[model samples]
Target: MKPRSTLVRILAMATAAGALAWAVTAGNQPSHAATGPVADAGPGYAVEDYGYPNADKILAEKGILLKCGDGYIVLADCASEQNLLRFLARDRADVCFKVTGEKGYLALELESVHGVRTSDVSTTHLEMTAENDRVTYDIPAKTWEGVGESADGREHTLVEIRTTK
Candidate 1:
């Protein structure tokens, strides 16, 4: 049999060789796995812009934008808006909101707002656009109004809603 010292030296040399092989191979991995999309230049990181700060993020994840509102007028659940203040869209389902205080405004552009229901107390105005025309309406307070294709048979989008005392 080989001497004890010779055997110990052989084992240590083997271990060192194995470690060197591993270290060399470890650095050769594809850089894509190491840095992900940061390796790209055109659009480094995807940015979802829904107009509001973090509201864009929320809308990106949930397909909804309800975080946009000052305090007086805000997005509300479709079931909770009394079905009185509701909207219908072409590409999307339904979007709703709750308006409070005497005066408020909402800068919303739900694509294809074919239907609407206005509140009772505050006089409201709707800014809308159809195929080739832009129209504005002085909505009667506490009344249901259809401003889009549902009303004029022209596909329209409710770009903005304004209310006042």
Candidate 2:
């Protein structure tokens, strides 16, 4: 076998170095809005339904149903970081949930996760109220972003939930 040319070796080394740098920089970036401390689901936190739908239509058509020890829990929609934050900030009735927009949008939702299900699938506007439970330092949306978590621990900053109503 002939030895590789000097130019080829140099280009290969440069490519490898660039890739390494990108990986390091990307890995160091923060993904989601600071969830503060994630409360453990605790014991008896059985999940009756926990699956991802392909599209908004599918999710809206076939929502995920979860049955905990307390009662049945239906997840109508779930989003990541900016979107979640936005949904919470605008739609959630409870004002205690607080989040700062930075680096990216905050994830949020107004879908029915608890209580009785609704027939209306139309998007509704959200309003901010006064309450205190989840709070964190305010950061501009351009300063931070969020990512979704997978079973394998992989993260995605964006996600869409679907279900059948």
For 39-157, candidate 2 gives per-residue lDDT tens digits of 55345657654332343653355432211211111232343222332222112341111222211121223332221111222121221111322222222322222212211133221
lDDT by residue for model 1 (1-165), tens = 669989999999999999999999977876665564646645567765434556676577646544344456667677764634567677776777677777776665566677677765777788888777888988777777667777788777676777776
Which runs in model 1 stand beyond 4 Å of their true positions? 1-53, 61-70, 81-84
- Runs of candidate 2 with Cα error greater than 4 angstroms are 1-4, 32-165
Model 2 TM-score, 2 decimals: 0.18
Specify the highest-TM-score model's number. 1
Per-model TM values vs. the true structure: 0.57, 0.18
lDDT (Cα) of model 2: 0.31
Worst 10 residues of 1 by lDDT: 62-71
